[model samples]
Target: MFDRKEMMEAFLCEANEELQKLEIEILALEQSGDSETSIKRIFRVAHTLKGSSAAMGFDEMKTLTHEMENVLDGIRQGRLRVSTELVNVLFACLDALNALRDDIEAEREAQTPTDRIVERLRAIGSGEAGAGGSAAGSGEPGHQGEGGGQAPFEVGEQDAAAIKQAEREGMQAYECLVKLADTCEMRLVRYYVVAERFNSGGQVIATIPELHMDLDVPELRFLVVSGLGEAELKAKIEQIMDVSKVSVARYALTEAPSSEPQIAVAAAAPEVRQAPGAAPVKEQEQKRSSQTIRVGVDRIENMMNLVGELVIDQTRITQLGHLLRDRYPVDENLEMLEQVANHFTRVIGELQESVMKTRMLPIGQLFNRFPRMMRDLSQNLNKDIHLIMEGEETELDRTVIEEIGDPLIHLLRNAIDHGIESKEARLASGKPLVGTVRMTAAHQENQVVLTVEDDGAGIDPERIKQSAVRKGLLTQQAADALTEQECIELVFMPGFSTASTISDVSGRGVGMDIVRNHIEKLNGLIDVQTKPGQGTTFIIKLPLTLAILRGLLVNLGPSTFALPMGSVVEIVRYSTRDIYTLKGQPVVKNRERVIPLLWLHDHFNLPRRKRTRDHVFVVVVGVAEKRIGLIVDELIGNQEIVVKSVGSYIGKIEGVSGATILGDGSVALILDVTGIFQLAGTPKKIGSAPDAE
Candidate 1:
């Protein structure tokens, strides 16, 4: 017996995928003029849903799908077509399906859901409550009369024979078993993959149930009509990673004539249509490959994790080697063993990196969705907007890509809502009616830079200052003293917004602050730039991946900290001459560039007794176009520190993004440079100060 919850989850998951496709296709059909084919596609989705619900004993879904199928048939036969009224009803049906789907997903929430819906159907001449292709929907009026609706005119004897003849002679058949790996990330995708494998082979034969059912099974079994033998089948299954195994069998989903190959046949009606409709059908099949074999993602990740353990083991063994070599100076083999161990260490390091790369998808995959979003938004707003996206191909850890979507969405909405001006205003200013927003990305040394710039109305620094003062986020005196750059950054301050009126979209000004906090949590930075009436641009600099970071290890007052390499420029020895106090703050001059220096001692609130040493080591950090020197006691040499932010409250005051096993085997804090910057530099206002009278 299968774990019932697992089976239900798998089924709901598959149904959801099909529903997504159906929604997209329906939307596309609305945009197209093809009513005949659209109805056909809709019917197919309904048929599949109907069969799956019946198999699962979901009576409500089965009834709903049945009603939907009838409506689709009415459209298919040219008696009805997609109208605004019909589409609205379809949307209602879609919503019902979605609600039902949600119930299946989390049945705990399905309290007294739609149990018994009204049944609507119409028959030809004789009205009866029987299944029919042209049955009316429950959402529609049910004509009250005898034999109002019936399933359909009964299939004639010749039509039934013709259907059997087509199945027996015209169609080919084969059995397909698609077994997913226990570690398969998405079982539905695996199902699609297996379907694609067979579809590429040739044709498919009959299968059980008059309708195709979407099973919520971990292992999807279907019979295909393919000419390929066992060898071809094995080769194809091996191609898809996470496909544990595939074993084909002879039996179809149902029993057929003994003289013909067994194939699944919808037992609902033995009748078939020899002349199928000529509507163009798209194949939603799975991916197929023949050379490579499948390996579970978990297995690979596990192997990489085990290698990490091996690294710790190697660290221990190396210590042992050093102790042994010192005790027995004449031992030649011990020294050689140390060298071999070092080699393995390098190999394991490279292997771990390679494994991580396997999970790295290009940022472009997420970025690609924005063009369509922009297109829709532009049309809806009746505003001419152009988006310039660059460096979208930059790759990041998949984990980062997933979380970044919503924040980016909020930013885009903010830009469209407040940053861009109306067409009339643009024309009055002699600018093009279409506003331009430029989004660029590129790797700088070790960090990824993403920028969103709009050429409409540049942000007003004075407005921000006024708002900041009003919100008590800043003192009026502080807002007055802020620079133009600092003014633009006020948006990052919680409860700080310059907009006077709120709209459906933005105006709350909370989004930018949230974006700032979220990125900071990821050890990333966000900044804004604007010139009044020219444009506004938000520049976000993020690490290559949240999973790994290159760090510079430093020591300050008995504590070790890691500075991200992407943020560091040069670690230089500085004398008191290089650093001078200006207005109570320490500043360092390097190559004629004044870099404000933050003392690690004072930053950490450690004991600040004056050091006798005159020379100080400074780590120069850069974010956006600004640079600052961080004062540390000494550089403990350069080492790669992987940043891991711990959340389960590990009980330590560890401020580092992650910890790494040092050659000396000690825990170190990976310095949050951006966090430290917030600790250090006074951010310049992001907008301009008012002009002096």
Candidate 2:
């Protein structure tokens, strides 16, 4: 017996893919309203969805997409032009389809009412909606004129030549019309039956309006240059189920046979037929390039877990090999162990790379949805903001991708709401009336840098300071003493809003702080840069993968800790003379900048060195725009370490992100740079580390 559950899952997967394509093509149509390619692309997706829904007995989905197909058909035939109203309605249809899909996936009845969207589509398809221009080909059944006994429709030059050559070869040409059942549930399948049945009898040279998956219409016209007589062709087609009638006519290529050929009056307009050998081979290759199979995400994640285990085992083997080398300096066994260890390392390295690649997906999957979002946002806010994206092909780990999506959305929304200025303001400022928000992703060393930039009114530090004071987030004196750069950084402070009036979009002062927190949780960093009249840019740096990271190992007395190498700037030897107290806080002047020097031992409750050395090490690290000097007893070299989470019983230790096992089989706690800053003090002021009491 067939697995009905498995089959339904397969259908849902395919349905989601088609829906994604539908969204992309609709956005393309909105941008390039004259693009026929995008129009046809959307039509094809809707047709596929309609056919599959009907096959699965999903009447609601089938009906919705069927109506969508009618509207797309009208657009394809040039009867309806792309308009803002049309785009909005299409977006509504897309949303409704997505809701239906969600219901199907959850095995629940679809509660979303699609009647309004269907009625709107019907109006546009039938030319009743003013948005739909003139009705060239009405979206109605039986609109396809008579074909048999009438002259065959005009064909392309190449096809015309092919038909004449076939006539000279003693083959008679007949135009056959196959009228399907008006209420046929599977018209696409029944139409395929007619095509297959007639093609088996004789070669089907050409078809009017071309054969496609859309079956909203009731009739089909095929021009067959074959040996079968007209009566035999009609009899064979009528035998197919619900094929109401079949008409056939013999045509001479030399002159008009009798009446004008059947002009396909259906929404699927008539097109000149191309000869058999006239199409480019690239078309077939293009179709083959897009062929793919869907796999469950759980399976991919399971594979990743197995690969992670192998990596841990590889680390242990290397450690064991090192111990043998140290113990047996002159033994031949050590050499053999080394060889096996090296080979194992090579194999595991390759295996790890392969598994990681599977988990790496192009960031385009997340970037593709933003265009439509910006479109709606622009209209709703009346800002006329244009979004530009770059480096969408940059790949990241799937876990990172999923975690970064919400933060990125928050940043984008904040950019549009706060960073970009209004049309009048931009014009007054001598800038373009339409603001531009550029979102770019690029790989920088072992990290991915995503930047969202906007060209509009730049952030004013004074306003930020005033806003901070008004919200009681900081004292007026504290806000006034902050440098312009520190003042601008106040946006990330909790409950900091610069907007004078609250709106539905933003001004709640909630987005940026949450965005910063979320990114920091993923072992990522977010920074902002703004110029007085020039615009603002938010740059986020995230690790390529979270499974493993390059960390700088440091020692505080006997306890070892791992500092993420991405945040470590440099290590400097500091003597007593190099450190001084400012406002009762340990401060260090490095490169003409005042930075706080915090002792790591105080935060972790670790012991400090009893005998103070003449010189101590200070590891300078930067998180976002804030710099801090970490006082350590010793500095260890950097190494690639696998990040393992701390157990749930001791969940979320302050100043500690996770733990990793070192090569010597000792667990080292990974330090969280952002958390360290938070533990010390706020962003505006860095207080002395707490005493270990």
Candidate 3:
């Protein structure tokens, strides 16, 4: 016997996978209606789910899947054609399946009611529902009657043979139609009870829409092959509450020279028409090797923790070597120690790379879900949107991928709802009727850059300024003082929006701020670019991994700080004579570019060392396109540092991202480049100051 808990978990896992596949397949079918392979795939998934649910004794899931299988079977047989309404019903059933799966995970008895969705599926299958498909969904007199509504039910040669053999074994076969009251609640449960009654003494050979809940048609047909008489079956079904009617009919079965293989072949119908390209696609898929196994995230995280410890120890050992060399010069023992430290350093470096790779996952895992989401959103908003994705194979740390999904989703939705223009507006502007939103990800230096861009109406900074002033988020004077770029950046301010009215898709003004917060928390930054009549693009920059990074160690006064090398553009020395103030802010010219210069010690409230030299070392770092020059006392060179979070006691600091232990056994604050840029009040674009009035 199988462990019940293990079986349930396994079922849940497979069921969720099947449901997701069904969603993607259903969407594809809706787009390309002539794909025979997609229909067959959907049918097989539903059939397998039905069998699994039956085995697990999850009667509700089994019953709902039985209904889905009937519709899918009709589709596969070409009796029912694909339509928007049919695809919608299929999606509805998928949602119901998800709900049932969630209930199972919650340790509830799989009791999610699926009667309404089951009815809709049955109606679509029987031709009583859908646009221009049928109007008799209410089961009124004008609708096609039961005999003429659908193709006549016929037993395949294999089924006829089996029926004849059952008769020879002294079993009776009865066909019964059971109708229930239209107003009955918990109808699926009631149907399950009735199926159980027949299953007790006789086998339920088949059902019309296959023994689901009380459907919209108000009737169900069942075939039972058992020793129980027809009257007995009828009486048992009638005893089920809310069963309005039951009619039993006896049919004769004739079979001659039928073999098991013949029956099996007939029962398992071969695909009548295969898409021309499907065979090669299937062959290619099979040829591709699946050389991977699913590993739990916790296990990978544990491995990462061990690697992190190794890195810390390697740093300490290197520091010890420095101390030993300085104190015991020319000692053979110290020489051996140096050799061991060097070898250990190389070994640890290789170990860290291997462990980090294990934690790396392609960003495509998050990118693939957007197409379906965009399709649904476009339909909901009654707009035409074409979403294009590229560079999905770019890999990032699993932790970053997991946390980055929500922020990316917010950006995509914002692009669709606000950034992309409506179809009518697009045509009026001489643009394509179908607005396009493109998402791409790639490695930029040591960081992964993900962008969401659309070719629709760009942001109107004037509108944003006016909105800010009206919402009291900024005074009119402040709003008017903002440059075009600075006014657009107001979208990231909390509780600031430019929409005239609240909309379901956007206009809440909460999303952009949340997006920025989440990205900053992950040591990432979000930036936006807009043109007056073009469109908007949001660029997000994130490190490859959070566990370890190459950091440029810099000293301010007596304290040390680590700046992520991914954000460091270059290091330059500036003389005091070259530094000047514009609008009371320190600025410097580098290669004819005017860049803001900031003193780090002033922000951290640390006492600055009196400079004896006329020149100061400036580290030029940037987040997205905005660059800032950080003035520090000394350059301590670059090294790999293990990132550790500051204890919760102090929570978050203004410019500090996290803390990392250095080679000298001192904890250095890792500067959040994005935070510091924001702290410096740098404009998103250079020379973006408001024009003089």
Candidate 4:
């Protein structure tokens, strides 16, 4: 017996892959009408899913895919045309398949009903609805055995001799015609079931269509040599699922003997019609699959954890070597120890990189899902949207990919519902009839930058200010005082929305705030830029991996806190005389920008470090366009740190993202820059500060 659980897992994996391919091809077929390649690919995917589902005993999936195969076969044969209505039905089938797949994945059996979708597919296949219009090949004849005709199969000379021999042995030859119901599902499976029953009592000499499963023949003709009576054979055929009529008659020699064997076969199965390049493609795919194996996410995560530990140990060893060299300045043994530690550090660094790469995956896996979503959303809104995606090959850590999806989804949804102008509005504005939403991802320095931009009516800062004030999120004076960029940032404020009405799509004053929150949790930044009449763009910058980061370690009295280097803008040493009071808030001047200064000691309830010099060290950290200067006791330089979760024992901290161990084995809290900015609230203006030079 096979491992049933493993079998299901494999099936689910393959099913998801096939479904994704089907969706892409179906979309292509819709876009490039009459694309034979897309049609054939779609048909092949449906056929594959049909066979696998039948083998796995997923009756619902088997039945649904069979109907899908039938419809696709009609389109492939050019008997049915591609149209918007037909494409909609195909998309509906895809949706149903996804629902069924989800059910199977969760419960180990599909519980979603596929009846409605199956009926629609059958109707389209049978030309009752959604056939659009017949194509050039509609005039061609269908299955010869399906219509009234003489027995569709003829026995060969060898079969004739065998039949005669069988008769002499008290057997009889019979011609069987089986007619399936028009609404029958999995007609080929039913045909095979009846054929199996016939073979039980005797032998099936030949089938009209050469017994190919890919053929969508509604009627079957068989020449059987058996001892069973005609009534027994007819009863067996009728017992099948969709067999409507059966005729079993004793065979008679209708022609004279021939010198050579004579047999009849219908046209070769549709599988032979595959594109000429398919073989090479299949060979390449086989080679690729042979070289790779699927490892579970948990296993990769465990490897990453081990690598992280090695990194920590490497750092500690390197630090200890430095300590030994400093204490024994001229010792030859310390030189050797330093060299060994250096080599060990290099190896550990390489190992860490390799492990991290294992957790990286192309963003295409997530981007591929959006086209279908855009199709549905555009249709629902009665708008025309062309979504262009680029840089799908850019890779990011799987953890980042997982966390980033929801935020991306929120942005895209808002792009459609709020950013993109309606068709009429676009026309009035002299823009193109169809709006464009472009999503792109690429590596910038050590981070991945993803942008979602729309060529729609851009955001208005004045409107945003008004909305902020109207929603009671800010006072009128406060709203008016914000700059254009700051006004645009109000979209990320909770309970702030400019939409006059609420709908299912958006306008609930929710998404943008959550998007910002999610990105910040990943230690990333989200910013927006817009022109009044042009468009809007949301840009997000995220680290390549969240497991480790370069941190700027700072001392707050006896405690040390690490600030992510990605958010560290710059460090400035300013004279104490430059400090001024801005509405009771301490402010410092860095270049020309007025930065509010915060005391970390006060925030964390630690003892304040008294200034020992005329100059004070100020670390400037930022989230998007907002910057704040953090006052610390001392600067400990920058180092690579492995981030560790704070755990449930301490629950959650306000300004701390997580904790990391320093080279000295002491734990340092990693400051959440975005959270610290939030804790500081809005900065006091420099124009309002007293003692300003």
Give me the candidate number with maximum lDDT.
4
**Candidate 1 regions with alpha-carbon error over 4 angstroms:** 19-54, 59-99, 109-307, 311-331, 362-395, 423-449, 453-455, 531-535, 605-613, 644-658, 681-693
- Name the runs in model 3 displaced over 4 angstroms: 131-290, 682-693
| lDDT rank order | 4, 2, 3, 1
Q: Give the Å shift of residue 527 in candidate 2.
A: 0.7
Regions of model 2 farther than 4 Å from truth: 135-293, 682-693
Model 2 over residues 1-693: C-alpha lDDT tens digits? Answer: 548797797688778777877888889998898476687677767877887789888888899988987887677655677888888898999999999999998898888898888898899988898765654554533233454222224454466777766754556778777778777888778878888887686667677667787655567788777756777778878888888888888865532111111111113222323345435545544433222334556776677677776776777788888788788889998888889889988997897777677677888878887888888888888989889999988988878888998888887887788888888888888998889999999999989999999987789999989989988999988987899989989999988888778988888879899999899989999989999789999999999999878899999879999999999998998776777887678888999999888887766677777644566688999987689998887777887788889999899887889998877778899999998887768433343432311
Candidate 1 structure quality by residue, lDDT tens digits, 200-282: 86543432222234544456555565555666766877789788777665432221111111111122333323334322222
Candidate 4's C-alpha runs over 4 A off are 141-290, 682-693
Q: List per-candidate RMSD values in Å.
A: 14.9, 10.7, 13.4, 13.2
Candidate 4's error at 640, in angstroms?
1.5
Name every residue pair that clashes in candidate 3: none
Q: Single out the weakest 10-residue window by summed lDDT for candidate 2.
A: 256-265
Q: What is the C-alpha lDDT of each candidate?
A: 0.63, 0.79, 0.77, 0.81
Select the stronger candidate by TM-score from 1 and 4.
4
